[model samples]
Target: MAADITPLIHRVRRWPRRVVITIAVVAVTLLAVRIALPYVVRNQVNHRLQSIPGYTGHVADIGIALWRGAYALEGVEIYKVSGEVRTPFVRARTIDFSVAWRDLFHGKIVSDILVEEGQLTFVAGATEAESQTDVDRRWQEVIEDLFPLEITHLEVNHGLLRYQDTTKTPAVDLFVTNLRLAATGLRNRPSESGEEFPAEIVLEGDSLGGGQLRLAISAEPLAAQPHFHLSAKLENVNLPELNESLKAYANVDVSRGKMELAAEMAGKDGGFQGYVKPFFEEVDFNNVSDENKSVLTRIWENVVQGLAWLVKNKARDQVGTRIPFQGRFGDPQVGLWTTIVNLFRHGFVRAFNPTIEGTVDPDNVLPTGDSADGEGVASEKPETPPKVATDDVKKVEPEAAAPTDQPSKKRTP
Candidate 1:
């Protein structure tokens, strides 16, 4: 019995050495993975980016945070391979994708993405090869591969959005700078109170020539069709700075003035209701001078300036009109006659107010009705006559406006 016990004790005494070796091996393996994970992720990202059709991209570096389950991409750039544009289509200084721990605690796994100093540029030319819209490719698939988790929140800080048209006479380049955007509740996690629109998005930016742009939206992003309420405003834009684009597109130029624009829209069940109001303040149309322009072009510019002067609201120093619209998601009816009437009304009867009307509401929007092309127009009712409402143009608070059951002659501008 003593001999058998001694043999068992010898084996038991060596167990610590075996355990220590096992632990050391695991520690070394984990250390190697930690050191190599970023390199592996960076290569994967670069590979996915290159797979985008007609686009090429590179990732400068990648960083990983093991504890938080986060990774950051630095100095990311994407270019359109076929375009003549020199600027990169997409440039991001840093993009961070992290696990949303708060949602994880609630038994919902999701991700939050932060994009810093990002720039998105769209170029247009005469040929298809010169266009860089990213619409032709499966860019979304690449984005999904980069972040496998469902995205519930997104933020963009100090970003830029640009549109360039090389085919224009003087070439067109317009940009929005210092753009900040935040969106939350995109996954539509169930709420205790059961909110209809579970997500909220806000965007604020500075347009070229010192104009401020703001947009806010409350939406059910996962709905089968479009369902949302939106409001937007672009104000105090120095019109002269927009001459390049205006001349190229509208064949008109502004020598002096500022502009203010506001719009409110609501959509549900594939139907939408909205209005776009544009107010020009102290505008002076530039004299058409280029000898290459057709005589009709110069005549049209003169007519537009004359009409603007005639409809100018003396009291407000503004020329403005409201263009209301409503219909299906893609096709909408514009109130051309109504818009013309509003111009005269603004000048003679009542000066148009440069604030969101707080009129459009999701609850008031009607579901889309079956109609064929050139059929009966939209069924939305006339907007309640304009009055000086709140001056909260930066952000609009959704209001429950009275729903109209009767068909309206109003159309969108």
Candidate 2:
């Protein structure tokens, strides 16, 4: 019985040894494939890139590497020649991408594109400008021709954005830092009828002091129309710094308070309608710069001064005097009058038009009264005659007749 059990144990042991050997062989094979995969994939990538009509230069230094079941890429550069391909839109910098071989083999491309370090530039009018209808048709064609592909992850670090207006000589530069983004279901083709891969983008920067901003966006792409709906919120922005960033614009400055905004937009073919609600606290117009002050002054003189004068006169009549009123120094057309009125109601002005009719305190610092120190002179109201009592009229009538009878003898002057 012991010998028979030994035979069964040997059979089981033999099966375990075969399993180990098979695993070892498979491991060696995987190792060899990993070592050779980079070269093969790199060559394939080079050939595919060169085949594009506009590809000019290509260089791949470090090959692909697979470690821990993930693919890694290094040392890749590509340059754009001239091309008629319209898929990615503009033909600028077509190279400078590194990706995992597995992603490419799986028909999905996942890579971190270093756009900030690359020299990517765009010439907007290089292609002929078309009418809105034509543009829409072209966009529809492009969307229909798009192929399905996946992008697991994407990141842009320390990116630089520069724009040159068609007439401007110098380009405006902006820097974006620590931009981390991730996405899923990013396909060139629409998933469902109007489905798109959901995406979340986060951006942060300290270029403006105490003016950091974070924005989040999510959108779904539409079929045929290639439309997208997006929502974004900007937080913790110092409006003063933002205004300074817009110094290139002629007469613009943030007067007072920071700003936070939230908005949503959806459409296609460069047409969209959106509402932005901006919240401001402790906002004032007197804090604006000189240039902006001039603009504000002109607007006030033309559009608001007449209204203000009327208010000042009415207030004087109610208070029986002219009170000291500080007029706002911002664009009156943009609800500055309402702000001033609110400030007046807040006791900043000595006299303001109150809902309750008739007379304000003359001693109020606003336009109602003259100052005790003679610093301000109050406007005087017209005098009104005193009213006589109706009953006292009869008492004076008899005295009037007696005076007439005596007057006949008293005329001996």
Candidate 3:
């Protein structure tokens, strides 16, 4: 028995040596794959992106932990238009997200998306030029095709946005920064009757021109003409800090001024309506800084600024206001005071008239774009809080694209 036991022990010890060596080979192989994973992911992502209909851009680096059910992206840049650009239209510092473990094994991809420290730029006049490099495709459709995955939740932290239109006089470079946004129920499909719409969304941020911004929008985009309701507030907008944007877009600059704005618009069926009222609490316009501007433009700005100070409503310590609005979404019949007070003091006198590029389209649901070609118009009720409201959206065409119910690269300005 002793002799048999000794031989068995020897064989057992030698067998362990082979097992240890096999285990070591596997460990090294896994480590190698893990180290090489980022490169593989980067190449695959770039290849997929380049294959998009009209998009050509790349992801810089990726951090992957597939077993942990998550991945992250470091730098992402996509051109505003086709070909190389001095500044890419979209850039993100970190984009991290996770997928459901159950979904992965089933071969179905679903994810909760998060984006951090990103910027979206809209260059107003990019079209399919004569150059072969430039290709124009429907932005919303392109996005839907690229990210066909199901999304249940999303968050955006510290996002920056810019709207630039160099066609203007001083060139418009409007910015909104420090944006934090969240949403759910974004990808719901409609029933046979119609789609349940206006996915709840909350957005808060600071305007680079000096103001706190808040927006609540309910969006349901599956319909031919999407339905939505949006309420926006711009508080304590500093007039002086907006010199470049104001001077370029509206032909005015200020030394010291402050304004608060409240707007609630709802659209349904094919039209929309709402009221936009600007409250100027304390405003003092100083001067213009156009060394090479036209004589008429310079003189006009100075004259308007002077008139504002002289005739500003003293009782309220403000320049008088009016809630002027119009619409293709439906005429809520917003009131514009035609009284003598408005003639002397109003938003028009102090430059709060919202326009698209150079064309004034009161029908614009959010004071951001142009009139729509849809059949219906919008109107506002007499007294309603910023509760759930509805608006309709058709494509803004070259002006700006329509935003989807989710947060993604296809976000429109």
Candidate 4:
């Protein structure tokens, strides 16, 4: 009986060795795939990018290798050879990324990207000869045919943004810290036939001039296109500093103050439209000079004169007294004639007589025409009518008729 049990035990031991060998083979195969996949993918991606039309100076770094999967190229840089270069997306130098294991098997590539410290520069007024339409068209083609990757997680530790008017300089800089974004369901479709996907993004930043920003954006997939909504709030920002940023872009300057803003936007046909109203506290205007004031005064005077009669009548009826209205002062040449007209019309000053009060009427009270004596009355008077004759005496006894209080006594004498 003992001898029979020993043979059985040996056979059972052999089964374990067979199981180990199978596992070893599978492990080797997986390891080889993990090492080889990144190089293969990098080469394919680079080759495809180089083949695209009008694409030059675009490069991708070597892919990272790992046990589970490969952590691929740190970043990809694309630039134009002749025109101004603008980078839409940039990866931070401190970022590390990992490839997805399932993506390799399913033929869908995915990346887990992390950003440590980064900065993005935006230049305004730097227009390229190529229209945005051309760029967009090329981008669509690139996404549809060349590159297809789903980004699972995008983590940013610290990021900075600097904006400048390319036509002007001394760019305004903005900084954001501890930024993070996660994305899913990224797919590409042709512009002619549209497809939609879901996405959500959140951001936080501390602006250079002294403010904080909190932002959130979301979108839902639709049949034809995806619709997006965004909400953002900025707190405790100095407006003068912000205005300096806008000086190169617009003609207005903002004085010292604080401001707040909030808004939402939706996307359509590869573009977006939205409305935003900013609220300011204690803002003042800059660049208001005497010359500018004069121009403004002329404008105001023109506007006021149009409604002057109405305003004057209303004021007289309500207050029973004349109100003094004047225009702003600046260059007097432009508005001199209008000012004189208004002054004479409103009896603001007496042009004819130095000592006369402005209240005196220019037509009647002043010495002019028949009223030269300044009496304001006509000088002529009409004469009285002559006495009428009495009726002729029809008979010898007929006599003239006279009032009792008249010359009766005188006639008898």
**Residues forming the 10-long window of minimal summed lDDT in candidate 3:** 390-399
lDDT of 2 by residue, 223-323 (tens): 34323433344445554554434333433334544544443333333232222334343333343345434655456534433333333324332211112
Instruction: Give me the candidate number with maximum lDDT.
Output: 1
Better of 2 and 4 by TM-score: 4
The best-first sequence of candidates by TM-score reads 1, 3, 4, 2
Angstrom error of the Cα, residue 112, model 4: value is: 3.8
Q: lDDT for each of the candidates?
A: 0.77, 0.35, 0.59, 0.43
Question: Which lDDT tens digits does candidate 3 get at residues 112-170?
Answer: 77887777776654434312233344544444443555665678777777666655766
Per-residue lDDT for 73 in model 1? 95
Off by over 4 Å in 4: 1-45, 48-60, 86-91, 94-111, 115-121, 129-137, 140-149, 160-163, 168-178, 185-197, 221-223, 250-255, 267-273, 284-413
The worst-scoring run of ten residues by lDDT in candidate 1 lies at: 404-413
Q: Local error of candidate 2 at 360, Å?
A: 47
lDDT of 4 by residue, 314-404 (tens): 3222101111111112211122344345334433332211110112111222111122234421111121110110111111121133112
By lDDT, rank the candidates, best first. 1, 3, 4, 2
- In model 4, pairs of residues that clash are none
Tell me each candidate's RMSD, in Å, in order: 10.3, 28.6, 9.9, 35.6
Which runs in model 2 stand beyond 4 Å of their true positions? 1-37, 46-63, 67-69, 75-149, 152-170, 188-210, 239-245, 251-259, 268-271, 277-413
Colliding residue pairs in candidate 1: 324-412, 325-412, 334-412, 335-411, 335-412
Q: Write the per-residue lDDT of candidate 1 for residues 1-413, one digit (tens) a residue.
A: 89979988887677898786897899999999999999999998999899887888999999999899999999999988866666788988889999999989999789999988788888888887887776632876777789888888998877788888889987887787777888877774464457788888888877876788888888887777788878788888888777777877888877688899988787888888778889999998764444576878778888998998899898877899988787887688887888898999889997767777666667666676232232322333344522212233233222233212211212111
In TM-score terms, which candidate is top? 1
